[model samples]
Target chain A: MKKHPLDDYLRVARMPHIWCPGCGLGLVVNCFLRGLLRSQLNLDKVVIVSGIGCTGRAAGYINLDSFHTTHGRAVPFATGLKVANPELEVVVISGDGDLVAIGGNHLIHAARRNTDLTVLCVNNFVYGMTGGQMGPTTPLTARTTTSRGGSVDRPFNIPHLAAASGAAYVARWTTAHVRRLEKAVTEALLKKGFSLVEIVSPCPTYYGRMNKQVTGLDQMKYFRDNSVIKSGIDPKGVGIEVNGPIVVGKFIDRG
Target chain B: MPEREYLAGEFFLSGDDACAEGAISAGCRFFAGYPITPATEIAERMSERLPEVGGNYIQMEDELGSMAAVLGASWAGTKAMTATSGPGFSLMMENIGLGIMTETPCVVVNIQRGGPSTGLPTLTGQGDMMQARWGSHGPYSIIALSPSSPQELYDLTIRAFNLSEKYRLPVLVMSEAATGHMYEKVVIPPSGEIELLARRKPTVPPEAYLPFAPDTDLVPPMANAGEGYRLHVTGLTHDERGYPAMTVEAQDRLVRRLVDKIERNKADIIALEEDGTGDAEVVICSYGVSARVSQIAVERARGEGIRVGLLRLITVWPFPDDRVRELARQVKAFVVPEINYGQIALEVERCACGLAKVVLVPHMGGRVHAPELILEAVRQAAR
Candidate 1:
């Protein structure tokens, strides 16, 4: 039997993570651990910070120095860690609702300041932990608990937001494209000055059920069949729609 | 190693500038702040000075980010702080609760300007006194210091850092615009002469370290992040292991320790300056810039053959309740004057328990209470 490469990086005692099955957050964490391992960075000096949400639990599961800060606060907290001791590699892993909703100001400003930290925003289109409310990334006209009649508000184009706000490295990949995500994560980890990887993940339990992708596998198939890899295309032109062509590629890489 | 020069003698400095020097002298190595009136100089001074001392200073996006960064830096084994005023202080309340809940040691300076919401940005106000004690959502005790002058701001800021370190909680140095912007001669002692306090580090090996477990002093030893201690810090009601328990027992154990740690140590935490309270008929109670105004009032009252005295509070929270009770028994009345409408006066009234008549001299927050106004209150209380 082959040994799991990420087993040592997980807090096995806190296993059986709370992320719902068919949820992309678990895979995101898996790719994160794999990326951390593949990058060959000093694991002891890497700190994971997460905010409130189902995706926030990624900080606790990682067997490294971690902080589970307040809702929408992981980026600023990670900023402090990175600024205080430049030697430590700070990574912020949080859900769409947490990263861009309550924490939008921090996200934009951190990118603006070009603070040396990597941010992994897990975009599941809804607030998964709080029972799938319409979040900042929810596609327009998508049915969520908060938007039962279908959302009228426009959603954010996260990759475009990152690139516009001055992130040095910006990329997007769906969890179904595991290898691509792992590779993006590794590349992001090695880049300096506010790199962000927006992983378009599945929320089969909440976001999926409301929008009719009833199972985890159904959501995975959607990603496999619909995702388009336009590596050199402008990020501003790429925004997900209901069952839309999910854009997956490295969009920006610079100092 | 070269000898460090943290102090230069007898230069006139603003309270905000003095505070930055005070922080550097106290071994504070990280500062995160946003620019707000009455407090911007602290951030300005820190930005220029922190780098020279091998410390890091960052101007955050907002007060919320500033407070969060301070907490993060503190956990990374750096004594960290942030400074802001009125509007900025309001934004920082939520994370101040996080600092208290997680028992993070940091200093938050509110060089207060008048505000309900940016009511007076450049003017002095002591309106946030009660907010400082109860601004955060939860039930918790905090240590807040009030400084009357630039010299006191310099001295008390160091004490604020020391208290934050000893108790493992966020300590507030509450300065008004009058004090923060005022220029005065501040004598900063040599680094070796100034007593500094460091948080207790875990003595046990990494495997045995429980992040929130208390010692006899009720303060748990701290482990910095990235030190390979595998520390898990959270704002949730957590157990001694720093894991979220989410049970009644966990809430009781955690919340009680947080409050009791400061409550039990009030004797050592509280500081004040007293004059003629033993033989006085009426005691004038005040803090911050108001205390300086009250000093003049007390002097005038004494010359008028009134047995008036001053009880100037240096530590406002974990307030001098015991002293208030003792004075209420002997004195006929207490005269309280503050820049606010009537904030700390209520505390005085509560602690008096109606034993001594509490006379509040209120001001609507543009400037300090005139000495004549405080003197009139003292006269009325004396009669």
Candidate 2:
């Protein structure tokens, strides 16, 4: 078999990953790998930790010393790895429900302590693993299985929450902007204090089907057309609403 | 910058403080915990001591985070620990289950307080004895130790770490409010004098490494995160390769090994201090502070010309059922005294298996058993 370029970074035997056909997790992972390669981090010294979700499976797929932790616990688990061995670069990759909802306390506390960690939160707007339930990141009025009549609860603006909780670096990007998202990941990896990179990925099977976007391409097109790059904008003003303009950029860089 | 790693002297210390020192002596380099009554002093001591010994101390947001962090640190190739009381211990159950599933080596010190729900934050209770064994929602085995004095707390904390690393599971030091807050002289041995057991590291190269594959001892050698092994660990049921195998065969294989590792090694794991059980008419089975109280009762019963003996359980979880059964045949009745209402007594009754009568001297909590009450029970059992 011909070796793929990213083969060195992935667990080839664990291929045919469980992600759905048009899911944006693969693209986000690709961006992450490129960014990791571009950052020149010693692959041997990097560890990935993930909570329970579709994105959490990334830990098993990655070739690093990865840990698939319990639900909503990736941040604290990664925090442990980082604090115990400060020389190792620990990264937490989890989803919206796993991060901002059940794991909100740990996320805020890690940011408050400015614990050196990079958190990659894949915002898919619904709980894809549990059959499209309404999550903390679901845009208001967006339909999900739990929100068949449309959600009325306010969604958490992740970047704003991180910045308010004392994260030294915070950024938001959609899967459509792979190059920029990859750049953000590289920068977040290199940041000294707590850093957050929110990847707005498409969940075609759950979030997409429940809403009008039936395929990942539809969601990507919407992102491409609607995203407004507003670098240096206050994160509080970057909330996503139903059918609203998607604001994307690095909203905070303390360095 | 080279502060003394071991105190190496005699000092009066509370059980909580002694527990912290014991962990430091045992090479526990990472401490993550949340503050709760009785157990807070352990966290306090670690906060001040960990940095001096070049270790990490993190006060996590809650007990769940604290327990998760401890497991993470353990996988990062460091001996880690956490301390909590009843409420915090309840919060830690989820991650404790994770630690058990992953077979991570760490220490969890539960300074038990009175509780069905925040029952008594500042008082002692042995109520969590059953919880220690059966708390985490699955069929699993656990090792737990009870310390009656500050000195035992110091000695047993190191043993807890050793047992955890040896068996590749979380070991629980189940102390209660009485021992935790009691100040007594505790002797600290030299660093070289204290025996320490590190986790067994894999001998094979990364390509041949099976993360969950057991040696003859049924314990897999551990690899740290930064080591080139690239191990994958998960809480889900997994195969020897450390990949999730979601089948009944895999579940049976994994769960059985996890359980059998401790059960088959019970002789090496269980510890008890027996006195006068050879010809006694009545035997007192006790642990923690209750053991200390039962000693007085035993002596008084002896003064009254009754053949009474004391069985002090140092290792509580793998509850010396074999020893209990053997003694039950020779004794008329078994008197079990604990701070809780008949938790360990139920175990004693089950182990006796109708050979002898089991009497439980239950205390509601906040205090140890009255020596007279236990002595009265012993006197009646002898008659």
By DockQ thresholds, what CAPRI class is model 2?
high
Model 1 lDDT at residue A40: 98
Give each prediction's DockQ, rounded to 2 decimals. 0.80, 0.87
iRMS, candidate 2, in Å: value is: 0.6
By how many angstroms RMSD does model 1 differ from the true structure? 1.6
Candidate 2 lDDT: 0.93
After superposition on all CA atoms, what RMSD does each candidate show versus the true structure?
A: 1.6, 1.0
lDDT of 2 by residue, A83-199 (tens): 999989999999999999999999999999999999999999999988889999999999999999999999999999999999999999999999999999999999999999999
Off by over 4 Å in 2: none
Give the alpha carbon lDDT tens digit for every residue of B227-286 in model 2: 989989999899998898899999999999999899989999999998888899899999
Task: List the pairs of residues colliding in candidate 2.
Answer: none
Task: List the lowest-lDDT window of 10 residues for candidate 2 chain B.
Answer: B1-10
Task: For each candidate in the order shown, give its overall lDDT on alpha carbons.
Answer: 0.91, 0.93
